[model samples]
Target: FKLSLLQIAEVQTQTYLEWKEVHPPQLPKDAVPVFDKKSKQTLYVARLEDCTPCFYDSAKKSCSVSTFHGEFNLGHTVQNRKISFLLNKDNFEIFEWKKSSFGEVPPLPVETCNGYFIARNDFGLGYITDNSLITIGAKKQDTTENEVLTLNHDIKGQHLTITEYQIGSAKASENIAELKHFTASNKNCEAAKQQVKLDQGIDKTVSFLKTRTHTFGGTGETSVSGKVPLIISIGGKLGLKYDYSRLNSKTTSTVEKSLHSVSMEVQVPANHACSIVINSNTFTADVPFTGQLTRVYNNGEARRTLTDGIYSHQEVAEIQALVNPCTPLVDKKRC
Candidate 1:
């Protein structure tokens, strides 16, 4: 049997009694009326909400709202058999509901949660609290594939956890590999510039290094383990904020092989605006003023400022080229 637009609401004990008093029992078509065992009165069932019809169960002696299209009984709960429904056929499919060992309803599918998500490949973790989400561990999936596996755990009966995994897509894997290569190239460039600085002891070498190594969309990769838990927190009225940290990464291209660290902090006010500050130091080269940049976004417009104020017009143009490589300096108004 098939039913459309099914909605369920719990009945309060008092409300049920009042409803029983007002509308007495009546025999449904092709079905006999069932009387309450205690009251010995015929029980009446009425459509409380918008639906098709109601059904009287002879054995249970209860009337429940239901719809019928064929021989199957629609919108009625049955023992040992789970009920499922779907709206807008393309988006979802009907699935059976499962209960935990304690007879409680299991957590709903993770896709049903509405919020921003950050994942690496298919597996990721996240924490949600009051309009804010703190994503830790690996990144989350960014595709439409249904092969994701998510494990949820309740910690000490106080917190909710979500862990997701899926087969990595080809494009995603290629992107990750490309990022690693770009990081290696950037490392080599930074090392060459630092050697020039040490050998010549001149600021001119720094200028040349900054210009030659300036590349947009080529940031290095941070080594992150998938075992780290993803924390998600939601439900608040305050502004949104994010803090990301990755430690214990080393350069893959250099002989010295010093540690590489990256951290990012972002703030978005409740008024729907964003401000960001990024700081990093790699290979002992002061590329872009020791790797620091600040930006503010409002109403789809962006304004960026350099933290270190020691650069000529040509140098500023070089930095601006890295920031917005496609837009020429002559056309840019804010930098």
Candidate 2:
């Protein structure tokens, strides 16, 4: 019931494990360096492992991460429950059907609607697109364009929202942190380094995972009212061990899940206008010379649901985040 059909959660463990065996992920060759306003002198990430320099710090025989605040869902919108997920397991199946469906189904190729819109990615769990800017769940029930959301926000629910946010706020460094000694790990390419706790808040996440047993609601009836971890891991494998329990109850049960993700960054070339268009809106900003942005995931859980033939049960787990970058390095060329 965990990864149910409607869940549409990305199942990349097997695929990533296979890919890692062939060419295990490397720390990003270069970390977009930054100038730390608090320190005056630029705080550059100078760590690496497995012959690759991490986006944060993986070399210098140590692991370091930069922490920042970012979120996925604003806790104000509701995601639509997809009926298509019930019939397909992965995107490949969906793609196969679309390729031969004779135009009956719209083929979702990264961008759609002649570039008018794109899929909404919620970390790596799932994504969606709608005809409206406010999305389906944000509108009042009586509105003319009101549409249905998931079971959590159908007609029965009231004043509900899907809130995914870190409890703090931060300004991204005006400059990117440089990746020094990129080739330093080459000579000692025996094993990857382990995680180091500097400013990164990994200990906080681990503490929450172990001590907290009651499942908190993530979307409806949930708010960011507790201490949240600002640091996260990326471009690395996460050995996620979560507890599955009934909502608002003390009873629990479950196992561990390992997720593999490639580190990713998006940067705008200098002197060229860079902008991103989403739906009907456009965003323009002044990015520094080191304009690379490393993707980050939250360090909390979700209120994902499970169902038997007769009833559905609600559960919660952590999510993805951005920045305060810290990641683990394992053997077999993993970092």
Highest TM-score model number:
1
lDDT of 1 by residue, 105-223 (tens): 23432121232211111221222222222222222212222121122211111100112222121011000011110110111211121110011111211110111111111122222
Question: What is the C-alpha local distance difference test score of candidate 2?
Answer: 0.19
**Global lDDT of model 1:** 0.20
For each candidate, the alpha-carbon lDDT, in order, equals: 0.20, 0.19
For model 2, give the RMSD to the true fold.
Answer: 31.6
Q: Tens digit of lDDT per residue, candidate 2, span 1-335?
A: 01110101110111000001112222332222333222232222221122211112223322222211242222221122111101111111101111111112133332211322211111111112233222111221111221111111111111111123221322121112221111112113343332211121111111111111112222212111122112122111122223222121111122234432222232322222222211111111111111111111132222222111101111112222223322222332322
For every model in order, what is the number of clashing pairs?
23, 29
RMSD of 1: 28.1
The residue-level lDDT of candidate 1 at 119 comes to 13
